[model samples]
Target chain A: MNELHIPTMAQMAAEGKAPEILFWVGCAGSFDERAQKITRSICKILQHVGLSYAVLGTEESCTGDPAKRAGNEFLFQMQALTNIEVLNAYAVKKIVTGCPHCFNTLKNEYPQLGGNYEVIHHTELIQQLIDEGKLKTEDNESFKGKRITYHDACYLGRGNNVYEAPRNALQVLDAELVEMKRCRSNGLCCGAGGAQMFKEAEPGKKEINIERIEDAIEAKAQIVASACPFCMTMLRDGVKIKEKEQEIQVLDIAEITARANGL
Target chain B: MIAQLVFLIILAAAVFLFSKNTGKIRRNILLGKDADRSDQPALRWKTMAKVALGQSKMGKRPVAAIMHLFIYVGFVIINIEVLEITIDGLFGSHRVFSRPLGSLYGLLIGGFEILALLVLVSCVVFLSRRNLLKLKRFQGPEMKEWPRSDANYILFIEILLMTAFLTMNAADYKLQALHFGHYIKAGSFPVSALIAPLLPSNASSLVMIERGCWWFHIIGILAFLNYLPYSKHFHILLAFPNTYYSKLSPKGQFSNMASVTNEVKAMVDPSFVPAATEPGRFGAKDATDLTWKNLMDAYTCTECGRCTSVCPANNTGKLLSPRKIMMDTRDRITEIGNNLDKQGKDFQDNKTLLDDYISREELWACTTCNACTEACPVNIDPLNIITEMRRFIVMEESQAPPSLNNMFSNVENNGAPWKYSNADRMNWAESD
Candidate 1:
């Protein structure tokens, strides 16, 4: 592991200070190996822009999205209430997360349980940063006209309708943004939602992730860009299944954006 | 006078049967738990107008939509003639409305004849589409014996009723031409006029044919009215109210469980303790536990298979079929109603909607994609029922799948879905 001095919200609070936003390190971002890279890329971008943000560190827990979606309401409530209590104690007002699931639960579901916060997905935050001219992209030809296709994560795209932010963030890279046939509201799920990531899929002709990957391939995208870690995992697995892992790269919007900015 | 008295008795019997069946259906729907969807009268009315009356969502598939609209409009407008039939049957009058309305009655009857002809054509096309064309959505496992037969039965009844109507008008026309008893020039029947010449010319035979056709037409309409309560065709009556009470919130919004929320709130708040009631089951395990809207949705389903056709899980070869969900719910409610009828209101059967009707595998197969809800013309929310059932299995029985069990434990102990302690949560932030 590379040394990265990430501040904690507790440290900031103890110092009688507050950052502009709280970076919610969702479970996947916190512990999953591949997802950790995306988390680091987001951190790199935040550091490069000098945007003040702090993690909840050990204070962060699962948003209980998986538990709730899996029908474990009691578990979901327990986890959610614990997090809500902490968030309320810190008087946290704004949250930015790399995972669409966390983004959805924190923004939409949490408010119902009195954990109201201005929650934003990392793509949206990245787009905002680019829009404000705080983050500048390198004018390099490395990915200037590369054919990139964006997969819409269900929780982000259909669940919350944040279709444009990821695209806008991708557009900042000056890459050709190709759309699969089923894009936006009509987009198919990568199949790892509603706690599907944890369980085996019921019998089917084909895995949904493979079907979605086929769409990405059909679009002839050189790079498959995603905004959610679960989508990144599913799409990468799909690319591997096609045995084109060497030819096609599956990357997060943060990774591509960080690379584009030479962060 | 004897004929008039007989007609009155038949009419009363039909009305009583129709009302009794409708009342039973209404009571079964009310057996579901109360949910206050009565807010926003204006929005509800607008939804009813757009979805039920305007058939806006049906427009997603234009061919079916146009055909459906024709039948729907015809069904509503043609029923006006029933008023004339009812009055005539009771008072032994002929051309009663024609005498009062004059030329307007001629135009009205002509318009009805044209609409009736259109309805007949639409019904035939729909029948052929279901039977001959064999649309994939219409022939799935969910549409087995009774559903298929029920569809065919409605179409057959519609054809017979329309034929009787045209034949009645044709025979009436022939009677007038032959100067039969009480037969006078009254209303126009442009479509039936072509048939008048083909009928028997004898005055007494023409009177018998006319009276026979009239009686069949009126009696068929009454029988159709009663049969609707037992058929998916009940959508013809319930669609309006079902659409009116549809969930007006954003499609993505899942209603939070209020009881669970209150309990969680009490835990979070130091000053509060949720009052103890006998700990209620967290979600629906039986038909009665579901909200009344869910039962109303079941009754209002047209079984058009639009929802099943678009369902991701069903299309992907999973066991989840939204149409089947609605049908099973309706079947369970009907079963409960029958049990109550036999055992007098306090009847308890060991059967439950969860295991007996809807299987756990079926509920688990749903992706919560909302495709079914969006595709449904009548706005049925199959996802809500699936989620509720899944909740019952998880919260009450602790019977979630093994993977879900792992996730629940992780969330409970580690505050996340992964098997890692919170102390290690920030390790990724420090990793290169």
Candidate 2:
């Protein structure tokens, strides 16, 4: 682990300085053990590019995506309004999130309730940094010619039509990008969306993630790349189910970018 | 003269029955809660044109699309000939248009014959696809008895009606050849010409066959018209109106709850005290709670299984069938309407759409992916209905799954979906 000193938005505001973007560390990034690595990877990429960023830290709350999706509209509104009040108090204008669910809620759903901000998914932010020549990647032989297939998170792909950003980020790694039969607009879900991640799956012939992983295997990719934390969890579980964990690795786009940059 | 009197009596009875059924369907659909989608008249018209008239989304499955187009176009065009039939049956006239229109009537009848053949062929293929080939989408638990039998019954009716039409034309051609009483030599029947050879050449028998077939054709058309309100075949009439009022907003944008949003606004504004109002039940627990557009969508469902075929959950062997959701909604509304008609509107059935029709497992299996909505040619949003019912379960009954219960409690105490407090949010950013 590397020591990383990250300042809070409150600290930045008190110092009469404002970070360019607020990193919304969603619940998965903040508390889930595996998703925490993805959060650190995103932080490393931001630091590597010399981007000014600050976290909401203790002041941040959930964007109420799960509650909304789970049908508790009242709870969702309460959660959304509390977060909106804190963000509005700090005059936060731009936000970047590692989770597509949070990104989607903040970008699409928050506007109606007066919580408007320029929300960008981490993969999209990374793609922007690469395009701007701020983030550089060497021809790393570690991932060179490695067959990788990018799984489109529903919220990032069909939910928002963000099909290009994550793929563009992976293009920088010099990996052979193989596409699953159901990719982009036709992508299948990882079975974790719409609050399914919080509940046991209903009885079915096969889990949705398993079916999705079969698509990855059919694509013959050794690495499955995902842009959303929920997708990463589902894909990883699928790989474990097939007992191919040793052969196949499920990783976030940020983790790949961080690894390639040797940050 | 007495024969014509009997025909008028039969026609009146059929019309009365058809109108009564139509009225009941209209009342049942209006039982749903109101949702104001009346804005954007130009957009609504364009949507109706593109979706219902143009059949734009049908192109997703090209083979089925073409087959459906043949049936759809044939159904619309052939009904014009029915208008003439209605006039003739009511006035006791024979070939009324042929006398004035002459050769144009020949061309028109010829065109109708061709369309009738096409509709016959399309219906046969559709029937084989449903019954013989047994497409997976058509055989699911949701399509159990009534749906499956209802589909075959409509196809059977169409086959009978088309047969009766061609038979009537063939028998009339024979009678005209014999120069029988009141049988004028007019209106070409190209397709039916082949069938004329199969019939007996006797004048008396030909007259009986022609009269019988004519009566059957007209009466069957009236029966089918009335049956439309009771069957999923109602899409023949409701598709236009349903598509006309389709949601113009982007699919991903969920509508905000005005009640909850106002409360949130009050929380932020210091001087704004929220009105002390009783909290109403959230989301839809039954068909009545749904919007009128949702009810229209139910009636507009063609039972085409396109939504179910493309549903990722159903494809992955999950129980969430979007087609079933719409069918269930329609069935529930009909039941409620019947209850209201039999007993007063105040009658309670002690049953609800939530448990009696749709199961919690089916509702929870949905991923809210919008694939069903995208695949629907009529723009029915099953995801919207699913979300509404889920809202009822969680908000009104507090019956969310245990895992969701954990997440809810965590959100309440920690302001997030995890058990950890916000104090630990920055821990992930800390270095070892």
Candidate 3:
């Protein structure tokens, strides 16, 4: 019953000024205050760069991804059509989102629903913000010596092959980056995403996220960073459960980008 | 000679009765599952050929495969030997054709007997590896359901076969000594030499014992043959076809949702609104719901346990066991086949054989990883069956993991499964 929604690239292109850019705010971004804040920061940056764009809010429905994956094809279709109706009404095109799950669902799965859109993750956009010299890092010399390890969300890296964007954004900041043995394509799931982030995992001897977190801790990192809200939440919870919350902080890629932009 | 004739009659009668009872056994297992004839002649023949003859994917262990091959070939070739032995018992003849040691007729019998002995030794190794030593790994639900009854039958046949060979050799040694006078040149055979001192000095009595051993050997074979269609030995006929027509393509390809028709409507239309179909029926619940090839896979498993060993879910101590699923499906299929005449009589409502076969916990434990399918030697895809069951659990019963309920509700209410307020969707972009 996980209702997913997707906005079509074709319909979005035909309407509403073809918004110089589209903001693909995912389910978590719609709900989580911090995630929403990061998304708004990126939109503000686009505006500052003289790029006009439209944010669709919750009119963007579920991506029909979780239902299809859970083998509930019927529910997936309902969510897909509902979102398609919304996009057609607004005449919206193009999208940018902070949530990797929404990004993947829109870029990869929506085409199956006849809603093909050119979707870009926010980190890819943030690097553009830095390369154009439109934004500069804040003097948070506090972050200078901190050893941060980037946890690759499976969807962004393995699922869709968006590996370097997050890392490249992290490089623009001065934090030292550590690497886990299981990184990139071989990265472990944070027991979230694929609707897994919402449901309790099939009962097993170990929590998948804890297992993933232990790998990050083994790298001796002072911070764990990610691009997806689900990974951020799961890893943050994992750090607390492992009693490493204060010792190792979890931050979104956008949070890092915003801080580097001196916001 | 008259005693031998009576023995032959009794052995033949026992075989007939055993074969007759197969239908009953087949029916009892089919309860709770749909039993119907799939109308694909080409598929049936292809499955039969691949599973029965090829056994190409039995396992990775070549030694075990070679040993099993010897037993398989011996079981087939020894049937001819059994017929020759049955005739000799009924007619008071020692040899099928009267001829000297160098003659083709004499040589033919000698070669068959040698091969039979070789197969017997190989079966001993197979038994030791499987049961006594407790070697070989297996996963999935069906592993636990292996009926010990079949093991007993296999052991009894092996014993009878070895005993008959030894006793017949002892009697032959006595006959050679009494008829050919010392027969030192004929003593080259090792088994005959060991039994020569044990055989009675009377030449006619030696021939009588030899005829008795022949009856024992032939009856043993008949008993085992009648067991074929009913027992796990069903794999002896099923594995070859499962291998030959196995999914030659990769497991990653989703069955094309775009091209599939209504009859093949495996997925919901991505373009339409969602509606309820049936309860407890999102995927396949039982055998009939499976594709034609999947049915073939159920019959073809050799119970070798190779697929079970490599399963990550099983190794990690989850309840999903792939071996048990195959065994249970075959067991269920045979039961349904036996009861085909009953016509839609609710088998599950009976609360009979199926209760002990497959469990609900075992069914839900699968992650649909395709690991078991990849590991199977004969290409039996256990994940296919597991996924089919998942469909039924969700679509028909409207039952799934409790967490999925929360997810379904979130997706229904919000555009996604997350529970945040709609107003905050773009808070990130506006934040300092």
Candidate 4:
């Protein structure tokens, strides 16, 4: 808390100071221990790049992604409309999210509910920052030759067709970017989507995340880079299951980019 | 004269049965909920052209695409010969277009003969792939005895039909060489020429053989037309419209329920009381609760199991196969349609798509990953059906899995899915 004085949208509005982008730290980013690291990494990048951004902090609620996906539309819409009213009160224009679920709900679903705003996943923003020469990654020698594979979050890749953005962001890393056999639109899920993370997996011979981890293992990737917070949780759990946590590390794309850039 | 009359009667009966079945299918599909897919005609047409007409998505598997193209192109192109056969059968005329078209008739028949041979080979390859090779996508619990046999039956029918076509051409070529009555030298038969010498050495027997083959080919085609409605092979006809009405929006966006929206609005504004309309069921519990497009998607499924093969639940040995979801939907709808035919519209069968066809366990297993939807060649959305049924389970029956109930409660009480207080949300920011 020393030098990092992150302002909430409430404080920014009260001070009559407008930020360029609203950083949507989704539920996982807000509460999950591992996902909070991704949230911090994204915040570090924004600070390093000198982007004026504000978070909702305590004002933020779950984007209702889990509720909506679980078929509780009433609860989802109630949460969504509350967030929408608060966002509209600030007249926020551009938003960026650390979770694909949040990114998808804000970008695609919120518009019809009268909460239209320019929403982007953090990977897309990071790629844009690199392309614009605002963020330099020439210092990414930490991952110079590490064989890193990216696990496509279903909400990001197939859900919204953002396959290239995350991959392009990885280009900034000097690490070797390997691909799972089922990559891009054909990428396998980590078995945590559609509220499956909140419930016990139904009876199955093998859990889906283990199957996904097996794919990553087959690719011989030393590091599996993730983009979404939910995916980070799933992939980490997968690594733990196979007891390969010491050998194969899972890091979010933002974390990788932040580390590579010396942020 | 009597021969022409008999041909007309057979053709009429085939056409009547075909139309009747097709009409019934249309009616059954329309029995579902209404949804407006008529927006963006230009884009819809383009998508249909690219996916259905061009078969662009089939290129995902190069081997299957080329093999399918052989049959698709052959099926479309060989119909020109069917046209000629129809005219000849009706008027008792031989090679009716020969004089008008001149040498082009020879060129056309030559191409048809070559295509027929390719179709024969392609069907054999397809048959072996299904039976001998047994690709995993073709095997599943949903692909029961009838589904497996339906695929085989279509291939066998295609093989026999193509053979009959070539044999008819061979016998006709031999008769033409002999200058037999009504067998003229009008068409080329490159592939069938090899079999011409093997045909009956006598002219009269060649006539009988030629006529027999002609009857078989035409009859087989008519029967196949009538069989399309009952088989997964219906994809050949329904894929066009199904692709045209594909979900144009992004996959992650589920349609917000208007009923829920009204309730929430009323809670906030108080003055925004919605009209007192008869409330529809919260989610789909029965086949009729699905949208017309969903019902059509069921009929359009080829049971290729592409969706199921890519399904995470199915891959992990879960009971939830997207292919099974679709098959069960189709089966339930067909059953309901039959019940309607017998017992009238007001009659109730007391059966439902939820418990009877698709178990709750299968619905709960889905992660809603969209792999199934992306993998479907015809764009059938099993996710939509899964979600629709989930809505019924959650809202109508309140039968959600116990873990999800806790999640819903946590989100309702706190601001997040977990039980953490909202005050702790910025703790990570402060620590960093």
Per-residue lDDT tens digits for candidate 4, residues B325-381, read 999999999999999999999999899999999999999999999999998888899
lDDT of 1 by residue, B1-432 (tens): 787898889889988998899999999999898788999999999999999888989987899898888888888898789899888988989978998899999999999898888889989999999999999989999898999999999998998999889989999888777777798888898999998888888888888888998999998998888899999999988999999999986555667777887777776676887765445688889998888899999999989998888776777788879999999999999889899999988789999999998998888877776667878898898888888899999988989998889888888887778788878888886557
Q: Which model, 2 or 4, shows the larger TM-score?
A: 4
Q: Is candidate 2 or candidate 3 better by TM-score?
A: 2
Error of 2 at A31 (Å): 2.9
TM-scores, one per candidate: 0.89, 0.90, 0.58, 0.98
User: Tens digits of per-residue lDDT for model 2 on A115-136?
Assistant: 9999999999999999999887
**TM-score, structure 1 vs. true:** 0.89
lDDT of 3 by residue, B302-402 (tens): 66676566543455455657877887777666656545656564545343222355565665555443546655766687766665565456656778677
Screening candidate 4 with a backbone cut-off below 3 angstroms (N, C-alpha, C), the clashing residue pairs are none
Clashing pairs for model 2 are none
DockQ for each candidate?
A: 0.55, 0.60, 0.18, 0.86
Interface root-mean-square deviation, each candidate: 1.5, 1.5, 4.8, 0.7
Docking class of 1: medium
**Share of real contacts kept by model 1?**
0.56
Per-residue C-alpha lDDT of model 4 across residues A150-224, encoded as one tens digit per residue: 999999988999999989988777789899999998999999999999998999899999999999999999999
Put the candidates in TM-score order, highest first.
4, 2, 1, 3
Q: Which consecutive 10 residues in model 1 chain B have the weakest lDDT in total?
A: B271-280
What lDDT does candidate 2 reach at residue B343? Answer: 97
Q: In candidate 3, which residue ranges exceed 4 Å CA deviation?
A: A1-69, A76-198, A201-263, B1-54, B86-94, B97-114, B130-132, B136-146, B180-205, B241-249, B253-302, B330-357, B409-432
